[model samples]
Target: MAAHEKMPDFDVIIIGAGISGINFAYRMQERNPELTYCILDGRHEIGGTWSLFQYPGIRSDSDLYTFSFAWRPWTGKDCIVHGSIIRQYLEDSAAQEGIDKKIRFRHKVNKLSWSSSPSMWDCDITVNDTEKMSLRSRFIFLGTGYYDYEEPLPADIPGIHKFQGKVVHPQFWPDDLDYADKRVVVIGSGATAITLLPSLATSAAHVTMLQRSPTYIASLPTRGVFEAIVLKILPSSMANRVIRLKWMLFSLFMVSMCHRFPRLAKSFFLRETAKILPPGMSLEPDFVPSYNPWDQRLCLCPNGDFYAAIRSGKASIHTGIIETITASSITLASGKELHPDIIMTATGLKLRLAGGIAITVDGEPYNLSDNFTWRTAMVEGLPNLVLSIGYTNASWTLGTDSTAHLACRLLNRMRKRGLSVIMPRMTAEERKELEERPFLALSATYVKEGGNVFPKTASTAPWQPRSYYWRDLAIARWGRYQERHGVVEIGLVTDLSR
Candidate 1:
């Protein structure tokens, strides 16, 4: 007879092998080479969200330098990269760093249970929608984005089912969707709708962008002069740093300029937009947004492609309320009808927490709103959990890298101190007294539609997202992280000596 010793699946578990998870894992593995880890994603491959979203002309809204990892300098000439290119970059990086071998794909986590008796996480997963798998780990890093995977938010239009041609959402774009030499109507004016308009217009007989109101649209050259000048003198890596700093500062200045001189900026943007519109087409009553710039995200069209589409008479913009969708077209409230061959609803995403997994700590289910975020990584009272969401205002990867690196630093510090558990122990008084704000500060339609159900941010340190990229970079990268302030603590479960 023999007694067998059990072993956990991994020393650390990071969910979703997207850019965020990959970067965090790299940082963690570099800091603690002894720790064994696994990366799990519901999808059958890495690239997480990028792999999930497949649509025509789908590309990053943010520039590559800011959107990519700080260490990975994007040497490509195009600042804005296509989704496939971005996906490949992630795949190649993971392969080069040996992180690809650690990924367990097709593992859809259904629940997560954190136990106190033996501090670890029980990650319940469903494989290929049939098989059940249970894995355990000492730490759980959730790189699962806030967007719901099941479906996009319901923006029910009258008679959508009656439409006979075709209806598509960018989230689940069919591989066989064809609109060549056909009329198409794209509903909504967000980034998706904006991207789709020019893309579909290239082959489609005509493409119509039908929106209820307007969203702010801005244009910049595909490549910046600042980057070109720096790369000429500096090495690619150092040139990247110089370009990123200048770009970041320029972004901050633009944001400040928008706030202080809204009218001046608004006038300039509309003027630029008017340059590419069809002759005598007023930007007002169609392109001009009622809200201020950066209220919702400003749509970016590289090389003025979106504007050039209209200028070439390949596309049209209609700002009117939709009455309903008919068999082959849409009916506006103004008694106008748009007969089109295809319809695309770019309504927005359905926001969800932890990919809608049932999470419990010590047998009690937790609500996201009940816990304030501690430095955008850990939630109040949640032990050994790090949320890897990105910035709403800046490049998503910028925030991702900062949060990932900071979490790695904390994990390394705990190992050095011989601590088994680390948690942000919030004071009850602080919880009651601290000013509460929405976790996502942006006024985007997606956030407005589905973000209320998620967590709330605090008005103070370690809880509030400063929203300033430079200020946050300093705090997350080099702040004096201490537990004596009573915000967070590290614990030794048993005897102090090993």
Candidate 2:
């Protein structure tokens, strides 16, 4: 189909109807009720990660109180909610907010190109399992969550094809694949593996967790006193403060536990983990993390299910590199062979920007790899494109909520000022100063490989702001409505016509 031949449907097109996209749609509607909009999701449903992740014992690692939309408080007492419940909540939110009508399911966006002449974007989209169609809009919002699709099953393993038993990736788990009374081996140590181990152990004859490197794991009560206080005393506007206080204490303890006393920290994790296991079972260091807490994602055990599975003698931990995979067994580098009825690879996901859509300005391709200064949520040079990247440590929604507010504020300012687009202008020297800073060096991949070209302030965490909710709240508030950092410049055509 010709790009321009596809009908232009709305003023703005939002990709992915996940939390970010849903919230963006709500905010945009609130701003202009009559403005036309359409939300497209590659999946058949609205909930992005929540809907895609069907592994057992799947739940939010972050607290639910602060993990949700600021406008809607989580009424559930459990601070960490399960995947099914979370998916339900998202569906309810869409229904209650009347945003479901705007969503187009099973519509995947394949390519996006911007025309400088019209200052608009032409998006190539596939809908209803049909041939690709075109969608043009004034602006494009990329809400495609960071974790794109399912984790890829390792393809390099020798004789992997010979595995006669079922081999699955957690991202693409089969609905009817039964693990009951069957031996299951789960590979990888990230969140998905941790979540899958305990759940499968409940029914599986035996389950083994294999990890190449150790990962930090922490356990906390699903419900807490501070959470109660926030529910009672704080309004939605002030809830961020309470969340910040809670996060501060938690982060501090995590840092100290991992850094000050490594042995003690390891012991603490093992001890707590041991509680869930059967009386005679032991918590091995092989499953525990070697890196400092928060260096990578800290695995969460919401209700000690992982430990419980181990205690019941249904699960075991194996730490070593995999040598090869046979039809019914996994051979480790140490010559240990694990026989399994099912092998679940919980490996990580591939990171793609803008839903893996290509971007072009004035028919010239724009490479995000070439730009590196991320300001607020806006890429440095990209106009009319805003990204939704969630928090690394705390609640993912917290960052997105704040980013949504800031984005709305910026958009409103531009409209009121009669500006079409806004771009941050950093000079060669100022850009150089930003480039030389060590703070920006932490996320080398995000900068170097992810094509995340933007000017970022020194104050953001899990990267710079310390991952404390309180510190980030302050930074978010300060930058939320600031117009100076992100200023609008009239396009040449608009200025000339004016």
Candidate 3:
């Protein structure tokens, strides 16, 4: 009587109700209709990041055309929209597809352990913050995103404790705090900070963006004239597909150009940024970054709104190391001081993998760093598991959908073959020749600071780091799963009687 011999609760258990989770559920149901699956979310609601961050002017850094779920398609007029709108769209998407019913909200998965006897995964979950329960499933899909939702990247300011005024972190913004006509200082030059500047500038007497180093900011339109014309002429479904493809190609092209011609891309970015800045504002101290283009993600300023705030004389940009923070002011290394009524730390996210779920195999702990990712979806040496992580270079949903479809395809193969277990393994010879690399290609602070939270990447196929969406999508659809020196194997199925 082994632990896994008993019938599992479900065929699959997805670990988050966020964008990746919802997308996985849809793909699983579509491709494998007979398979039973449930989504477990730690939060009470559906939207993950969108529901979590409620700061003013929070929006998607990528265009909604590609960022939105592929099946539902974003019908909004604006390509870049507010966080609330994205949440509403996700809610509607889940409800319309009946996926919302499959979610078990507030059921936090604490740990997952794979039992080899019957080849099922045992899940330890906490329901409603009080009751503890255990469940079993044949497969576990980790839709848990790559960031620590509970804790953001710590603010590294020297004297943050001494600040008397209202201090806030964008990850945990207070809803009731009003900053009307009050001086505000936003820390960091990332997308969140850029998005917050123009928004806070509208109501605040003054807003200053405080960054230790300059980051490249690129202006993008909320709605393009070409897209508008295409929407007007084409049918709704056709128009949605057209716009999505357009943005997909554009995003890929931009990233490729930046990588292939770094000098040209840097020049173009600098030229465009200078045009939008206030007259006489040089690019040296505030706009120029020491790194090459696409080394880190470029901060997107929708419609030049952040620049508009600066031109209005309500917002300013200051780049210098923080010396100290007193009761009401932040002193810079260059002796300049900024007095702010509200200090918003839009610093960055704390990167984490599988939402910090402790994983085990055969009663032994499984460390993620020890394994290599198989096609950026499945991990080597882990059985019946897949991690759905989005791309940093392109739209997050594209990578998620690719992984989802690939998982479904693998599941279909296993079911048709009467196989109960699927595991990614590597030969000893192959392991020796494999070159391990960082999971993410970006040199962003958060990615570097994450410190091996993600699994390692290799230099070869199905193990190489995830990059462009088109190539990954192709691999997901038609790549050889059994080849590649037998990287993935469909293990024995003894539970056919069930």
TM-score-sorted candidate list, best first = 3, 1, 2
Where is model 2 poorest over a 10-residue stretch in terms of lDDT? 438-447
Give the Å shift of residue 167 in candidate 3.
1.7
The candidate maximizing TM-score is 3
TM-score of 2: 0.83
Model 1 lDDT on a 0 to 1 scale: 0.82
Question: Which 10 residues in a row give candidate 3 its minimum summed lDDT?
Answer: 489-498
State the local distance difference test value for candidate 2. Answer: 0.69
For candidate 2, give the lDDT of residue 87.
84
How do the residues 1-498 of candidate 2 rate in per-residue lDDT, one tens digit apiece?
Answer: 565543356767888888899888888777656457889898999789889888777888877766777666677878788988888888888888899998989888877787655666788888877878887776677888665574443435567788999988877778899999999988878888888888888888999998887776666678777767876887854765566556646655675576668777767766666566566644454655555455566788776767667767788887888888987789998999999999887766555656666777777787754554344466656776767767665677766766666566655656566665665554566455442233222322222443243224443221132244444456544644324333436553321112
Stretches of model 2 off by over 4 angstroms after superposition: 1-9, 31-34, 150-158, 225-284, 425-430, 436-488, 492-498
Highest lDDT against the true fold, candidate: 3
lDDT of 1 by residue, 209-328 (tens): 999899877766778777788899998778888888776777777777777888887887788888877788888899998887776777899888888888889998999988888787
Relative to the unseen true structure, what is the C-alpha lDDT of residue 211 in candidate 3, on a scale of 0 to 100? Answer: 92
Candidate 3: where are CA atoms >4 Å away?
2-5, 494-498
Clashing residue pairs found in predicted model 1? 375-462
TM-score of each: 0.95, 0.83, 0.97
